[model samples]
Target: MMRIFLMATLGTLTAFAPPAHAQQAGETRLVVRPSPAVPATPTPDQQAAVLERFARARDNLVALREGRRSVSDLSPQELQDVLDYDRRVRGDYPDTRGAKQQCIDDEFRRAGGRPSALARQVIALKCRN
Candidate 1:
């Protein structure tokens, strides 16, 4: 009895739902579908691509710290911006790469050397021999 009452109440609620503009406009109803499942592991090519990108970004960060690169397109903005902000908010700019690395090393230490899955992969591939 309780189940039937709940089903009836649900049916009534659905039946009285505000009409969609699509229905009023006489357009085809949109079909909802789940996306395909992604593979648990990246392909070799995908891994290589990520490593390549990481190398590029790391080089860019180094260059930015050294004033050897343009700041217009800092791919990993946090690499420089966070350190810049921390200093500016409390101190000033013209900080060294050692300062930036210090910030990152501190953060990496805070994570107990356990980076995110992506970071872990990068560290294993790039940071490690």
Candidate 2:
């Protein structure tokens, strides 16, 4: 009777142990789907549109960083402008990489102040509020 009880307890404990295939220390299981084919190339009009969009997104980011606009304060036009800018910049603006960050730094410098902890806090609060 004692041996039977010990065997049953060990069996139950082993049964509840995590499965070996569940996950491994350095292995990640990712589901991959085939991405749709991209167009051969963007046309001239598409290029121009992309440039314009980048400029607009840069402007929006600047405004947001400088406390000129809030997340909730954007109008439909502003939202569309920012979205268009994002798509264009991501698709086009290789020359103006980090343009928004540069603009923010330039504006901060031009305003006769450096970006401080307080300024970042203010921007964060303004963005959230």
Candidate 3:
């Protein structure tokens, strides 16, 4: 009777043991949980920095649009520089993403230039293409 009881207890314990796949060759296990708070908003200084970065990105885009500069003409490093500036601006000033493009389109329209087609192309190129 005692042997049977010991066998049952051992069987239950083995069943509750961690799975083989859960064990790494040389790592300890840890449990992680997501926090329940919203991320903090950027400060005023960060907002200004974001605006400046966006302006720099816009200037690069303008140069690329004009014959004064070419995307292909830029070196790999220069291309990366532009992309990094764009990412920084987007990270901090997400609301301005479409707004800035709209502003540019409005300017062109004010100048009596039909810019929807070009604006679409620019948006495609800058954000996706």
Candidate 4:
């Protein structure tokens, strides 16, 4: 038992340690372990607040995207496709980080334009937590 405890302790320590590597010029790294999350159920008020904020952010993002898209450029079907995708994402992944936003931004660039407002909101939503 004592031997097993020591091995486990050593293994955990190593897991928390930085890599042993030669530093490059101006190389820097920061490592942090966040506190373990306590999954407490949200109160009614808390849930309401979260929903309100999410709605505001989502509306703002969609509005920005609509503002940027000229009605003539994107066909009605394409516009509906984008909006439906947006809705599905929101419903399917309410707590999800904006992992798809990078793809969105990349496509936006390939098509030639700045990051859309919706893209920015995606990043912002992830940061809110």
Candidate 5:
């Protein structure tokens, strides 16, 4: 008896309820699918291309640091507005290749030939290779 009452009440409530806009007007709602959160991995060829580009950028950085090359010599097509990128890279790594080696040697001497965790992290950040 209770089950029947519940069923009847449910039916009455549903019957009296106003129809949803789409259902009432017989209109179809368009749904737009969202893009994937994670981007697709690069192909081998794409990876190689990126590596080569970075290698070129590294060479450019070295040349610019040593005063052997000018910003105008950088290929705009290969690295767009490369001067800014070079500046940022230089800012992050203030030391040149020789300076970095000297820094590492000094750090080792300062640590008394036993590098601590902080020293290791410093070396890693200051030295590229």
Candidate 6:
């Protein structure tokens, strides 16, 4: 048990330590570099498609909140598309953060504190973007 404990401790230390070569070179820190390749701009058609998906997802969320639809009625692809688009846009447009957060808050309230799985799904689709 003592040997095992020592081995585990040594392994943990080894896993976290910087590369041996870096240590030898007198470097104690790691440098992180951002990606060099910029993401490709979306074409007009692609942008339109994303907007359409967002609209559909929002409509579905509203229907769900109103009890006019069920979770099964929600489109996973539509939710994912809007979320992915939002992820990209939020990074580029910091000004949108406030609007997006407000949307999320409204949706959460509309979900009635997520009393049901369907309510949770509605909030995710409506405001997770």
Residue 16, candidate 6: Cα error in Å is 45
Candidate 3: worst-modelled 10 consecutive residues by lDDT: 120-129
Please, what is the whole-model Cα lDDT of each candidate in the order they appear?
0.67, 0.73, 0.73, 0.65, 0.76, 0.72
Error of 2 at 28 (Å): 37
The TM-score-based order of candidates, best leading, equals 5, 6, 3, 1, 2, 4
Candidate 2 similarity to native, TM-score: 0.29
Better of 2 and 3 by TM-score: 3
Query: Residue 81, candidate 6: how far off, in angstroms?
Result: 6.3
Tens digits of per-residue lDDT, candidate 3, 8-110, equal 9999998999878877688776979888889789999999987886676678866876777888977786676678776675685445546566766666666
- Per-residue C-alpha lDDT of model 6 across residues 1-129, encoded as one tens digit per residue: 999999999999999998768767565677899879987899999999978877776676567668998766557875565455555656754354576678877777766755477776766677655
What tens-digit string does per-residue lDDT give for candidate 4 at 53-126? 56654564476577954546655655555565677776854444364666555556664666578866665565
What is the alpha-carbon lDDT for the whole of candidate 3?
Answer: 0.73
RMSD (Å) of each candidate, 1 decimal? 18.8, 14.8, 13.7, 20.5, 12.7, 19.1
Backbone clash total for model 4 is 0
Which lDDT value does model 6 have at 15? Answer: 97
Judge candidate 5 at residue 121 and give its lDDT.
Answer: 88
Candidate closer to the true structure by TM-score (higher is better), 4 or 6 = 6
Worst 10 residues of 4 by lDDT: 92-101
Candidate 4 wrongly placed segments (more than 4 Å): 1-38, 68-129
Off by over 4 Å in 6: 1-37, 79-129
TM-score of each: 0.30, 0.29, 0.31, 0.25, 0.38, 0.33
Model 2 Cα lDDT, one tens digit per residue, 18-123: 8788756887779999999986798899999978866777888779879998868877877877766666656855456365566555556754776678876654
Q: Candidate 1: lDDT over CA atoms?
A: 0.67
Please report the candidate that would top TM-score against the real structure.
Answer: 5
